[model samples]
Target: MNEITVSLPDGSKRSLAAGATILDLAASIGTGLAKAAIAGKVDGNLVDLQTPLADGATVEIVTEKSPDALHIIRHSTSHLMAQAVKQLFPQAKVTIGPAIETGFYYDFDLEKSFSPEDLEKIEAKMRELAKADLKIEREVLSSADAIELFRTMGEDYKVELIQDLGAESVSLYRQGDFVDLCRGPHLPRTSLCKAFKLTSLAGAYWRGDEKRAMLQRVYGTAFADKKELEAYLARIEEAKKRDHRKLGRELDLFSFNDEVGAGLVIWHPKGAMLRTILEDFERREHLKRGYDIVLGPQILKTELWQRSGHYENYRENMYFTTIDEQGYGIKPMNCLSHMMIYKSQLRSYRDLPLRFFELGTVHRHERAGVLHGLLRVRGFTQDDAHILCTPDQLDAEIKGVLSFVRDVMGIFGFDYEMELSTRPEKSIGSDEDWERATSALLSALKDSGREFEINEGDGAFYGPKIDIKLRDALDRRWQCATIQCDFTLPERFELTYVDADGEKKRPVMVHRVILGAIERFIGVLIEHFAGNFPTWLAPVQATIVTVTDNQIPYAETAFNTLRAAGVRVQKDFRNEKLGFKIREAQLQKIPYMLVVGDKEVEAGLVAPRFRDGKNLESMTPEQFIAFIQDEVKSYR
Candidate 1:
């Protein structure tokens, strides 16, 4: 046998026969690693532990403790689900099953939807197969042979997949009576997946083509330990309880009208009030950050979007129309108009970093299925801004943007992850343009000491981007901030500034948003606080609840005084009991409730009760107003 040299992360090497498997290498090291091993990363490619090695290669066994091991467990758990489904519902055809951020899902085309009962039965079978501990075997075969096998098994979707694979040979994973076409580094046995759960089911098209058959996708998540699994499930439960859609209706913050169509939100009066406060807050913050406020028309000629590249690469999401034989589009983005504003006059290098900010509302036609209230909407306002600067100013500008993003997210109490999305397969711009833009983004991120991951081939056709994933209070992440570097637009629009030498140089364009949307941010805020907004941003910061009819006059007086003091106080003067009023106020999550009963009124005092139902000692109306103002000031 030919000798092979295998290297480990610790700079250790072992000589072995050329066909040595990860399991063989691990045994050569110790039984402890071999048992803990789930897969191996061979020269940057993840492969099964049983995979044979070539003459010379770098190898590292992926144990349960490795960062990538959990994903492997989840992916293999997805295969176990397929095996369980096949054993119970043989007619279902599997298409794709991949591990997602927090879970795994398998899409299948079947005659009927799998109900809760069906899931229970399938889960029982899954446990049985897991107990059996069937070894997962890998096989490589020609695409033609794979197509024939799936065809014979009546898996038309799998057969269709083989045709589109565009590969001569495809790897297949088989365990027990189930077989799946996959490029896998799955767990060696069904028992290796220590903990698993079937999460939810949804409808998805075969290949994201709405015209194709809708497949039933069963989502699941797996973890190495039972406690971790339970923790995940608990987090999911908390997230569901905090879902913005439910809170929006329960708190009467916002609604969607069928006549208004999907993806367009109708902010009720209370919602609007909350939004106004947030917008005002953002405006003040932007002014403090030296951003020049700007605005543009909601609709513009098609020629503008064409120059912006929105009509070319993102036309599907844009709404189009015509005015007097000239094509126009509902502005899907604000960058183009910002550019035209810049090009209106020649700019000197002294005005190098011109930052223009806008609370711009734009419309895009999102798919119907993906629409979920403010989170995923068509017509929404973005706290959008554009920065046009010289190449020398790139690093400082991005760092400034990052600081701005951090401040906005801090106001919302959001923790976030950063991602640098590099060039896509189909993109414009010269190699130098791409290189410079990419370097500037990375430089800024490193300078800020922010740790970020890369998303390859997910950038805009025009340039690379920095995406911020803000995690809510429930620890659920949402992509709410983005900084994109665009080179194509500047070139297309011929946008340039005069340098110190009086030479015309194209300015680098940056698109950024801190709080992505006022509407969506409101939704997020609703969930983050469970509809209990900070006193400053609350629609009704404090409510004056009268104890009886006689106290109405006193309550009204107190309300008038607070309103004069600029407090959002509501007069709940109904003839209900004091306890009843307190309960109502608590349900509304009002920050403060000032109860004016007979004693308090006669004493010229108001008994304060926090919305949390914690009763504070009775105090003079003057003292009560002062206390509320302090709370609002602190934004607690």
Candidate 2:
């Protein structure tokens, strides 16, 4: 046999027959490894275990312990599910299926809706198929032939996909009588999808197009082991309990109405007050950092957007209007206004590092299906800021933004991860500018001494950026803050400052948002605390509950006193029982409940009952104020 040399990831070389497959190499190495190996990576590309080896190729066998193994298993599991569905309901036609972040989902074109019992049956069939251990073989065929085959099978969606792809050849995976069009690096056999479960079902538009047919989507998750699957299921249960949409309604925070509009939030009184407190805190922090608060018009001329590159890259997501028969675009970002402000006057290098901040409201055209409560909305406010500085001060400004993000996340008790996103395919700016911007972000991340991963091809259209994802109490990550370094915008807008030599030089622009969007941040916060906000951030810090109508006057007086002392107080002066009032207050998630009874009123004191059912000794209103203030101070 002709011999070939293959290099392993650890710098070891193996001489094997040219016709040898990855599985053969694994078995030759060790029995345990061959048994554990699910797939292999050849020359940095994932391939099936049975792929033929070539000379001077780099190979790495992927076992259950590999990070990429779960994804492969999940993708294979989705195929298994599709096969199971076909076996149970032959009339059901399969569409597209892909492995998502949570797990996987496959869409099917069927006349009947899938029920919970159907999911169980399909799951049982999947297990049966896995037990059979059928080999999954890949074959390449001309697109024309594949289209004809799917057409004969009554799978119009598959034919549509093939036609839309416009490829001359396509890859198909076959397991017994089941076959799917895919560019697959699937498991060698069905049994490798050991631990799997069908999660839920929903309706999705074909290819996310409203005009296309609606397909039934079955969601599922698979793991390398049973323990991991169980843990993921537990997280799903906890996630359901902590869903912000459910909590928003239960806690009376915000609402969306069909009558008004879709993807629009209507904040209730309590919710509005909570938002006010957050905005005030943001203003104070910005002022302390020497940011000049600024405001701009809600709309600008279309020519300005065209010049700013927004018209070319972001026009689809922007709302346009006509003012006096002239085209204008609704502002989707606040950076343009800040740039105009900087250009309103030319100054020396002494005016460098000028920071402008705004709690600016902007509008975007968010799709209806993607909108979920406050998480995705059409109109929302951003805690946005822009910094104009000389090139020498760019690094320090970038570091300052990272510091702000760290401090803010810490204050909210959020553990976060940072990622540096590089230039995308659909981006502006020259290669040199992108490299400089990315390097500045990389240096800042290194100076901060925090580990960050690189997200290739995921930056803003004009620049590279640092994205911060905060992990909530449930351990789920939320993307809420970002720092973008832009060299293109300054040049596009011709923003310049006079240097010491009196020469015109372009200033660097930094676009950042501590809380990406007010609505989304509040939504994340709701789930992070499970509707139990801290004393300082709570809508009602204290609620005074009276035992009976006789104590209403004292409760009223106590409420006034607490409110006068700058506490957010609510009075429950109804003719209800003491336990009933306390239960109501606890249901509202109020931090402290002041119980006003005859003994407490006579003693010139009010007993404090915490939301957690802890009872404290009676104290004067002044003393309670001091105690609450101390708690607030602790948070700061």
Would you list the C-alpha lDDT of every candidate in the order shown?
0.88, 0.92
Which parts of model 1 are misplaced by more than 4 Å? none
Cα-based lDDT at residue 150, candidate 1: 91
Model 1 lDDT on a 0 to 1 scale: 0.88
For all the candidates, what are their Cα RMSDs to the real structure? 1.7, 1.6
Identify the runs in model 2 with alpha carbons over 4 angstroms from their true place: 163-168
Q: What is the number of backbone collisions in each predicted candidate, taken in the order shown?
A: 0, 0
lDDT of 1 by residue, 1-636 (tens): 688888888888899987889999998899999888899999889999899987668899999889999999999999999989988888888889999998899998899889988878877887888899999999999999999999999989888888987899999999988999999989999998778889888999989999999999999899998999999999889878878898888777889998989888988887888888888887899889888999999999998887767787889999999889999999888988899899999899999899999999999999999998888899999999999999888888899989988877776688899999999987778888998999999989988887999999898888999999988887777788899987778998999999999899999999999988777777788888888878888898888888789988888888888888888888899988888888888888888898888898889988888888788999887887788788766752
